[model samples]
Target: MDWERFARQMATMAHDLLEQDSVVGTLERIVRSATELVHGCDAAGILLMDGGRVRTLAATEPMVDASDRLQERLQEGPCFDAARLRDGERVYRIENMTVLQQRWPAYAPSARELGIGSMMGFLLFTENENLGALNLYSRLPGRFTETSETAAWVLASHAAVALSSARSHAQMTESVATRHVIGEAMGILMAGHHIAEDTAFNMLRRHSQDRNVKLREVAREVVELGALPRPEQPSRQ
Candidate 1:
């Protein structure tokens, strides 16, 4: 390994990932970089899971998209396992997909049929959360070397931090927007009903609970229509 060149490349990759402005962009770049920067990786994708459902945020090829969908449908594969990583396990490597039929019964056969010969998946995680997996695919069996794994792991580490930061930024932006809408709704209610701030907030809260909706949604309605949606109460028999 060229330690000096590797260090320079790692620094460059970290800078590029951190500078990404959106989660989607960051994910796209991760997969794109995987194919470009990782040895023997012919295609790549980012598989994000929300509970049991999986979505491919980005991929280098249509084959990768199809592969992820198969994994989602079967609920079995290295990518799925990597996303829901067990304790002390952060990466999964299928050195020869053609021979691992039993390990991923449903996914392996189909993946092999699709010409995927090997796979490597790394969990995208923070200290508190498991975000997903960064998956690499190769069309030749046993294509990934120890060096390839080490380099890809380093990239995945940087990607996880960048992904977490992107999501945090997005959540903060949404939170600020929600607060603005809620404030506007509160102002409307206070002006229309001549109520105090606490009273207006209580009204919104009560409506949100009664409608079985989120506080943000209730606030959004008030902001758009300038009125609360009050469902009719049932009469006592």
Candidate 2:
């Protein structure tokens, strides 16, 4: 392996990751990088556990999605375990997907049928939390080596940090936007009802609870409609 060339490519990928403006963009870039930088990786994807259900993201090809679905259905696979963060295990590899194994008897044959000859999974994690798993797939047996794993580990490290940053930025942006919209709604209510700011906020909060709606949604209704919607009164018998 050309160590110097690999290092330069990794440097470029790290820069590109941070340049992504959105979480989705960052994920897409990460998967693409896996296919490009990870030796023998023909397909790649990110698998996230949402309430114990698998959510496949940024799949590089149809094979990746198919493999993730197989793992989700069987409830056992390297990627599944990686995303679950079982026992602090950070990496898993399968050099021969065609062979039935005790670790994943159901997944091995199904994955082979899906044209996967080898596989690798790295848990994407930062100091604060575990994000998910970055999965790599190859169609040829024994495609991955120690060098491939090393390169993939480096990529996963950068990917985790980039993913966390993107999510944080997105959340911060959404929070700021929500506050601005809610403030506008409060101003509208204060003027329409001749109430103080605190009263307006309390009215919004109460309406949100009474209507079984989010506070942001309730505030948005006030802003869009120019006044808060009147609560429905009980009908006379």
Quickly count the clashes in candidate 2. Answer: 0
- By lDDT, the best candidate is 2
Global Cα RMSD, each model:
2.9, 2.1
For candidate 1, the C-alpha RMSD (Å) to the true structure equals: 2.9
Cα shift from native, residue 46, model 1 (Å): 1.5
Segments of candidate 1 deviating more than 4 angstroms:
100-102, 126-131, 230-237
Q: Candidate 2 overall Cα lDDT vs. reference?
A: 0.90
Off by over 4 Å in 2: 126-131, 232-237
Worst 10 residues of 2 by lDDT: 124-133
Q: Per-residue lDDT for 1-237 in model 1, tens only?
A: 786788787788788888888888888888888887788999999887777788888898899989888888888888888888755589888888778466777888889988999999898873444358899999999999899999899989888888889889999999999999889999999999999999999999999998899998999999888899768789999
Q: In candidate 1, which residue pairs clash?
A: none
